[model samples]
Target: MARTDTAFRVIAVPPARAFAALVDPAALTAWLPPEGMSGRFDHFDARPGGAYRMVLTYADASAAPGKATPGSDVVEARFVDIVPGVRVEQAVDFVSEDPAFAGTMLMVWEVTGVEGGTRVDIRAHDVPAGISAEDHAEGLASSLANLAAYLER
Candidate 1:
């Protein structure tokens, strides 16, 4: 249903470093969650049409511990396009027979090499209209921050 998504842009210290951080598990885990949260890829195949899955854990909201999700959310995607250290596009889905995401979702990541690092732009289209834009935006912003932090280190 048309394109309804959030956009966030951030500069990475080094463009190549930013690209490298995305594919590395250690790097990925280091910066992929919001403050007070953590996550990592379980088994990621970054190639086109590859299966990508990641597990995210939220910290307890209070003094008590939190209940973790049983499994990682799985998405079925086909690499629609890829340019090494430059950009990537993937057709991802929720993997449910449900009509919500039974269709193709286009996730485009464009990275431009700048003087000091890189400017990255991400757009996820075909998102169900049912989801909240605020949540989506916040998640992506946190992820970008995480990515930046990982690269800086």
Candidate 2:
């Protein structure tokens, strides 16, 4: 499957601070979820091959879809690689019975130092057919925007 790519620039925040917002569990909880969602991590281990589980709840129950419950979406993930203040790669699978949403997808986040801030580029490989590219792209953009906002503050 073709991958989905998204990139964003975070002004006034260096690579280290931007990368911290990516790896830190507390910071992740604050900004990982896109607009209208809240996230909780059951456990997070920030190392290669480490496992984690995250539950994302929709602020509006009506916004949830068939692939997940009325108010939440669950994901089981493992860190494939971690380069401090630089990049993070992970393999993620949705905990849903829906066939279209099944399967593991690789997500890579590249952080680079740019003039005045950091540039974050994200790619999702083998994205499930159940998820539309448009929505995925939007969600990614929103997450990146969230990260920028969190870091700049």
Candidate 2 wrongly placed segments (more than 4 Å): none
lDDT digits (tens) for residues 34-90 of candidate 1: 666766655777675566665555565453232233332345456676778987787
For TM-score, the strongest prediction is 2
> Would you estimate the TM-scores of all the predictions?
0.74, 0.94
Clashing pairs in 1: 48-79, 49-79
| C-alpha root-mean-square deviation, candidate 2 | 1.3
CA lDDT scores, all candidates in order: 0.65, 0.85
- Where is model 1 more than 4 Å wrong at Cα? 60-76, 95-103
lDDT of 1: 0.65
Superposed Cα RMSD, model 1 = 4.0
